[model samples]
Target chain A: MKRLDIIRRAGRNLKQAKVRTLLTALAISVGAFTLTLSLAIGAGTREYFAKFLETNVNPQSLFVVADKKLVGFEGGNTGPKEYDPGAANISGSSYKTLGQSDLDKIAANKNISSVQPNYNLEATYFTYQGNSKKFTGQVGMYDKTIRGEAAAGSLPKLGTMIGADDIVVPESYLKALGIKNAKDAIGKTITVHVVQQAQTKTTEELQALYAQGGLDALTAATQGKSQDVSFKISAVAAKPATALSDNVQLNISDTRAQELADFTTQGTSQHKRYIAAIAMVKDGVKPETVKAELEKTGLTVKTARDLQGILFTVVNVVQGIVAGFGILALLASIFGIINTQYISVLERTGQIGLMKALGMSNRAIGRLFRYEAAWIGFLGAILGALGGIGLGTLLNPWISRKMSLGAGSHLLIFQPLPICLLILALVLVAIVAGWFPSRKAARLDPIEALRTE
Target chain B: MIELKGVTKTYGKGGNTFTALDNINLTIPDAAVVAVVGKSGSGKSTLMHIMSGLDRPSEGSVTVSGRNLHDLKKKELDQFRAREISFIFQSFFVQGGDSCYDNVSLPLEIAGVPRSKRQQRVEKALESVELTDKTRQKAKNLSGGQKQRLAIARAIAGQPRILFADEPTGNLDSATGAVVEKLLFDYARANKATLVVVTHDQDLAAKCDIQIHVKDGRITEVKQ
Candidate 1:
């Protein structure tokens, strides 16, 4: 028999058993819906992370930090030793910070083009026309590539070292200072008082002062004698809002930051330390090679791509779990196909006999049954994919809003190739599920089948 | 012509065996109307099955239209039956869920007749059975006589050289049975096709050109 005729007959047979065919197809749709949704979510998350990286990270830059084991006594201790008063206690661990020598060693590498140390500065109160306010503040060197959009005035030019008297404030500072607009504050000057331990002659002497008087004795010693530095506001920057870091209100040049540390530690023996540094690699050099060379110097190196890779791995795991469940549902539906097809064969025994008596080949009979299964699969996949896309579209707005993603961002994104491949795969699965039952129908004895009423 | 020489068919294995046909020897010339009449379990149906290549004989051979049925493989036999032979069953066996048009088109479809040609042949077959006006009605909705006629239309749709009717009117009333019988015989005679009828009705058997009687799994008489 011709394939078209067999397919038409199969369609007619399915129509004859409408309820059974529909129920079987429904079972397959459940699996298809889940599979499509999972794939969409995986694609959406990847796109989202890719955008985040593009917007916030510089591909050629690597963040270098002191190795955790070298920076902390928290992991395990070799032995207890005498304590040092000059060591900084950070996150419940006392460790020496990265200093000028560490920065120099990293900069000396052939692959590294430049190094910018992230300064850990002491906080101070801001004073403007006798009104003083304490706010959470940190001063960091500004890299032109890392700066966000400017709300007022222009960002200081790249490679222009910030003078000791230059400063940049966030938009929140303008609101707090009662400045009418960011442009108005750009040329104004503000005084920041640097409080210190009153310039002790030696490390032992400063340690004695800290132990005897704590903060009050130190404050009394520096009473009526704080160094007030006046700085002109170079620009007012837009608020930095991201999941990782925000709430910074001050920016300065790396040279100016080092100068403030020098002023505070005058007449003392302690050297300035940094928490981390950013190494900007030259273009066309592999970041991995630079990272490996830096790692040899006992520093931990991480590129933006590495962090993005971690996020991708996490997203892939989630997609895998969801797809696994979808496959399980499909496996269950396969049995449903087999069951429905077997029952159909039994019910149509006399018809089978009639066809065979009319000289229909066994291969033709098998093809008919398989064609019916393929039809069911096609219907199920199309319905399930459309359902998934519809539900995703309906839920996109609420999900985007909840996540604070801007308008037009989607949490479920569909791509054409994967969806089509998924549908084809499901059809193949249905064909495989129908194989045994179709073969049984094909091999049935015409005499016996005709005798079956 | 259809010929069976020393043919035997057995069911089951070992000690549980039962013979459905025993040493059957028969020949019916082309375009002849032959009736195989017998009581139930007397091997009339088995003889028809073997001769039609629907069942294989355990011993000896059956031949039809110069093709040895035993020499042909199963697939070859299917092709032979599809192109050369047709059947009308006692139960009608018309696909009830299908329309009369589809029921009549089955054999032609199996023969791989194109749609355009199949349409013409189907219409002619339906007209021959006098069911042309009911072509689109579902087979289940047809009366017994109409369903029987639909079966005859399907059987002859491929224009096969041989026709087999197994108790074709057994389920119909006397009046409906006579109408169905007349259509079957008329189509076969018009086409000059060999017609074999399996029946228990002596009156119906008497109308055929040749009669064969069977008893105890063997043919006891052949009268022409």
Candidate 2:
């Protein structure tokens, strides 16, 4: 008999025993339902991480901080135990700071493609030319990793730094800068002010100044200096200034940030101290390998993978628990398939004998039963997947709202390709479950089968 | 033509065995109607099975249409039976859920006949049995006589050279039995196909051209 004919016959036979077929398929659907849900969650969480990584940083970039034995989210807490002199206190907790020499050591490595020291640039106020009214906001340097897409001008080319004279303004800053929009703001200049402390007069110098004039002269010699710098508005970034986010940030070039850092902390202890550094690994080199090299030199490094693990730790555990139930359900359903096929083989013994007497080969008889199992698997997976996807689609908005996730980001995302592959795999598993029963059916003696009544 | 030589079939193994057929030598000529009449344990069903290539003899050889059953591979034996032989059992093995047309076309479908060719053959076989109007009816809805006739239609649809009837009328009344028996004989004689009837009824055996009597696993008499 032709294979297609056998399959048709098998399908017809399954239809005749609808209750048994459905019960077996239901068993498999139990597993498929849970598995689909788990997979959706896994895909959803992973997608957010991927989107976050691309916009903020690249995979090759690792956040390098001093090996301070840090275990807290900056300034949260650290149960007091050890007090090392090397660990400097910031806000409340202590952490080792990255020094100039430490930066030099990292820059000298063979695998270090580039290093960008995270500079703390503080601008007291900023105003456009002819606009004396100054707006105080957050000021930071334009590191290439902060990939804020442009609203007016082009971003720096990949693997390059912003020019020293350039500063990027936000669309929201147009009103304060007296410009209509980003186009008008381009090529305009803005002034930033920072106070530079003067050197303290020594005792002998103070005594000579006091003798020359009075207390007034000494006071004049030790007063702080106020300096102002202006930079051209190069571009307007799209992401930095949203209406809801009132904390505006103005970005200056790396050279400008360095200049501000040099002058502001000229006499202070924080002149050469840095909070962290971002190291770029060379192309074709693994970040973890270089991270290991950096760790050997007492510098703590974190790759993107480690951060993802930390970020997804809770979600992953939940997924594993749900997937465990799915696996257990699948294991039980395999037996359900075997039992169903065995009962079918037993009930159809007389039919099998008659088919054999009618010249249907034993191989065809076996194929008929196996095809029935495959059909059951296809049905179960589709039903289960549809159920999972349907429920997920309906619940996604509610879930996001309850979890306080941002708009347009759902808690569950169903990817098409893996779902298709999952269905295929379930079908194969059903075939394997039907194996022994089909073999038994094929090897039955026609003479004995005919006498089975 | 079919031939059997020194055929011995036994059941069980080693210490305990029951001989079904003992050293039976028989030859069936072409287009002949023959009956092997026997009591309940005479192994008449075993003889039909071996001759139809549904079972093999424990010893000796059986050949049909110049192909020895023992020499044929498993696939070839199935093909040979599909093309050259057909059977009608006492219990009317037509599928109860199937239509009369589907019942008749079972042998042809098993033989891999194309769909375009099967419809004509099935209708013709149903017409020959005078059940053309009932072709669309399910086999279970037919009377005992109609069921047996449907079995005959199934047997002859593929036009096999040999037909084996194992108590073809055992489940029907005399009038119904007579109708089934007449259709079987008329079709065999009209088509010039060999017919082998296995039964315990002496009256049915007498209707055939030849009769062989069996007792205690051995042939006791031959009437030709």
Candidate 3:
């Protein structure tokens, strides 16, 4: 018989035994449901993380830092290692110190376009206009690599850095500054105060300065006092929706931030120390290549892809566990198909005899039963996948609300290719599950089968 | 023409061997109505099985037309059966769940007839068996006589050159049995096809153009 005829006959036979066929398919559907849902959730989370990176991170940038082990820290390793005299991060080196030497090594790489050491801006108070009251909150740098959305005014455009004398403040700072709104605060001045460190002086030098200028000069030479810098309010940003970094009260231009950092550490032992630096890759260079080279020199380099991996690893494990359960259900359902098909074969012995006597080949007989199983699989997979998608669509809003992922974010997303491949794979599994029973049906003797009546 | 030469069929092994057909030689002419009559287990059914290529003989050969049945490959034998051989069983053997049209369409489908042309063939076969009105009804819903007619419709639907009727009227009343007998004979005469009837009813066997009587795994008499 032609394959199309066999397939049609198979479908008809399954239709004849409707209840049994559906029950078997239902068993398979349980697994398919779990697997498809897990796949959707997996794809959703991965895609969401990628979108998060796209908005906030530069793909062509690498974050480089001195490895704790390279900087003479014990790190996560258990065993002791031999010490070297040139080890950094020692006492007086300050926190997360990647000094001038580390910066120099990174700058020497051929693929690197520029290196900007992440500077720490220290401030004791922020006061804008007539609001002289000191409000202590963290200050951060607005650099070219940092992408932000403004609430009222516009942020720096692509390839452009924040102006040296401008600051971006949040809504809370606007309210603290007694400004009516973000729009009103634009072009207004905000002052940040820091205590400048006094330089050390010998008594001889202090006496010479006092002899030239009297008591006022002596007090000025020995005393340390607060200093304030002013910047125009250039824009306003909302509270960050991402979990990437701490929330800052206001942001200053990168150049001014560096100057503040330099002013704070002048004539100090930790003057050139840095916590992290963004190594911008050349236009056509792959970030991974430069990352590898930076790592070879004992620096820890992380590309955007690595960050995405870090985030998705957790998602993979969770989704894998769910899909694993689905596989277990599928394995259990295979036995269901075996049992059902075997019973079908037994029930249709006479019919099989009739077909065989009518000249249906043993191969066709086998294909008949196998295609019936394929039908069952196709039905179950379609039902289960559609069920997952339906429930996913309905539950997305609830999940987003509960997880506080802001608006327009979904926790369940279905992609076509994986779902189609998944259904095809399930159908193949069902065919294999039907194999032994189909063989039993095929090998049945027409004479014995006819005589069975 | 169907020819059997020194055909022998035995069952089991060593000590328990039972011969079902012993040294049977026969020649059946084309377009003839032949009856094989015997008591139960008298090897008449076994004879029919071998002659129809449903079973292989332990020794010798059976040929239909020009092809040696035993020498044919498995696929070739199947194709031969699909195209040239048809059967009507004692129990009516019609698929109960399928519609009358579908039941009759089975043979044509197995013969690799395309769907577009099978409908006319099926309708014609059903019309011949006088089940044309019951074409859409499930075979199980038909009475014994109608089911038997439907089985006959299925048998002739493939337009086979040879038809086997194994007690085709065994399950029907005398009245219905007479009707089935007429249908089988009419189909044979109209198509100019060879008809072989295996039966226990002596009266039914007596109506054939030729009769082969069997006893104890051997043919005892041939009547014309």
The best candidate in terms of TM-score:
1
Poorest 10 consecutive residues by lDDT, candidate 3 chain A: A85-94
Fnat value of model 3: 0.65
Shift of residue B215 alpha carbon in model 2, Å: 1.5
Q: How many backbone overlaps does candidate 3 show?
A: 0
| Poorest lDDT segment (10 consecutive residues) of candidate 2 chain A | A239-248
Could you tell me the lDDT of residue A34 within candidate 3? 95
- Candidates' chain B TM-scores in the order shown: 0.98, 0.98, 0.99
Model 2 interface CAPRI class: acceptable
Model 3 lDDT, residue A162, Cα: 76
Scoring only the second chain, what is candidate 1's TM-score? 0.98
Q: Residues A133-172, candidate 3: write the lDDT tens digits.
A: 8788888777677576687777887546778998888766
Report the Cα lDDT for residue B88, model 3. 93
The interface RMSD value for candidate 2 stands at 1.3
TM-score of each: 0.78, 0.70, 0.77
- Tens digits of per-residue lDDT for model 1, A69-109: 54223343445545665545555655556767889989999
